[model samples]
Target: MTQELVAQLFGKALSNPILDRMDDAASLDIEGRIAFTVDSHVVSPIFFPGGDIGRLSMTGTINDLAMVGARPLYITAGFIIEEGFLLEELVRIVASMRDAADEAGVQVVAGDTKVVERGAADGVFITTSGVGSIPDGVRISGSNARPGDIIIVSGTIGDHGATILSKREGMDFEVELQSDCAPLGRLVEEMLAASSGIHVLRDPTRGGVAATLNEIAVSSGVDVEIEEEKIPYRGEVRAACELLGLDPLVLANEGKLVAFVAENDAAIVLETMRASRYGADAAVIGRVAEVESSRPRVYARTLLGSRRILSMPTGEQLPRIC
Candidate 1:
């Protein structure tokens, strides 16, 4: 059964010579400064509105590399399947992974699979690891934000988490919601072409924009102030959050990114981001400034002209919301 399953994945899913070797460990060729990251996707339902666990596994790792201004090059997937899981579903998931990898211009170089008792595991869990090459002169990091830097977000936030919550809870809305899961490598490349002043790049995933910005503030030892009205948001997603008493800023977003760029080059960077397919809704949400207190902090200026500190999220608003 194991051999048959491996053969199926090799024939229909993975299309790489290194992976075809069926070796315990496949050799990889990496050069220059590379970014390496890994993430596990145990999202409930296995499939969601716009993506599935397989696609999530691929994009999640790819985005992680892209967050550091890296060009995603290679990835590996490890699957844990429950014994009674349907073979058809497994094939579908692997196919999604292949499509996502192709879309990101990356290769699935290796993988492994294991099966456990039906009740011991869910349908399937995917863990993905990726390696990417950072271009010369690129120095993106969370701690690179500086005073006078402009903060930009790629697009609307909270789409992914909101979609997952609605799906898992079997909630219906007038407008359907979908996960914003996607690969951002191309967007990063385009932004780099626009300006070299970009200091930080991050995908607001688990803890959303609020959490990511807070981390950047602490890491860069600077304060961040965002205008609530300036932040892009989908009306339906925001409404969904409001209905559930969830803060949209604290919700997860798989496809969106928050970038901190030098003030002088902020306009060009924002313009460049807006030109991309995934970043068509890019907006300048905030700015980095000198710490006003003994420590760095994040603040949001509401539409009513009231300012409130945007604290780091204490926990996931929707758990297993990859």
Candidate 2:
């Protein structure tokens, strides 16, 4: 298109001081250690119940940086639009990205766009990258979960996964299911201030809570035991999973995070998380088992009073639902 059209798209909605000043390349002032992350969004249908691909890309990248205890600061986006894609839709997506970035308190500093042949790519795809500052003494990692640490999930699981599934299947469940896509950077900052005993922080994204917990268990050389009843889920998500013969524990969550906090600080962290905007429904669902080799990597104590090993799905349960 012309310069006028491009300017109208990002001129006001996403304009920022750093971005406006940086014509060719972005320059910087980053203090302390920098946490960098990138993610691509190609979720099926492009637009979903709660968010579109643009919002997903922004939140996904920001959350990745937050998982490592970072204060998100800036973001870069790369977009690929199909040949016949409407310019109006493209502008709308750009506006959505700006709104998400604003909510996360980050600036969209730069971006690139490319148009491909008709049917060459999905209607639109976006790749987002982010950078943030990690405070000194904050060293969160997947391998830091220690025995006696309680596992806490930020909020309801399976909402994003179920929403995509319902929309894909054209099933209008009695209760409307919506994607829980959001930015978690602010939540992480509050959590760290509440307690310095946080060992690990992970957002259950593609592989869901089960995969994240199991990965942490293996990485930390410990076993995990989650009480099924304690796991949070909305009624509509539960019903959607039941109808599809799916397990909510393995479903993806765009907004929620699972943290491994020392037992002494678990209560404080839970309270802090519940008080945060993105973590209002936070709950402690499990703990790291002291005995490493005695049980499976990750297992759940079912409501029926039995434990079952939570294995990774042999194949993709919900493909392209990210």
For lDDT, the strongest prediction is 1
Residues 1-322, candidate 1: write the lDDT tens digits: 4746655664557787777777877688887999999999999868889999988999999999999999999998888888888878888888888899889999988787888887988888889999999999999999999999999999998999888888775565545889999999999989998999999999999889999999999999999999999888899988888777788998889898999999999999988998899899999998999999989999999888988999999966743332
Indicate the worst ten consecutive residues by lDDT in candidate 1: 313-322
The C-alpha TM-scores of every prediction are 0.95, 0.94
RMSD of each: 2.7, 2.8
What ranges in model 1 sit over 4 Å off?
1-3, 170-174, 318-322
Q: Which stretches of candidate 2 lie over 4 Å from their true place?
A: 1-8, 169-175, 291-296, 318-322
Q: Report model 2's TM-score to 2 decimal places.
A: 0.94
**Model 1, global lDDT:** 0.89
Q: Candidates' lDDT values, in order?
A: 0.89, 0.88
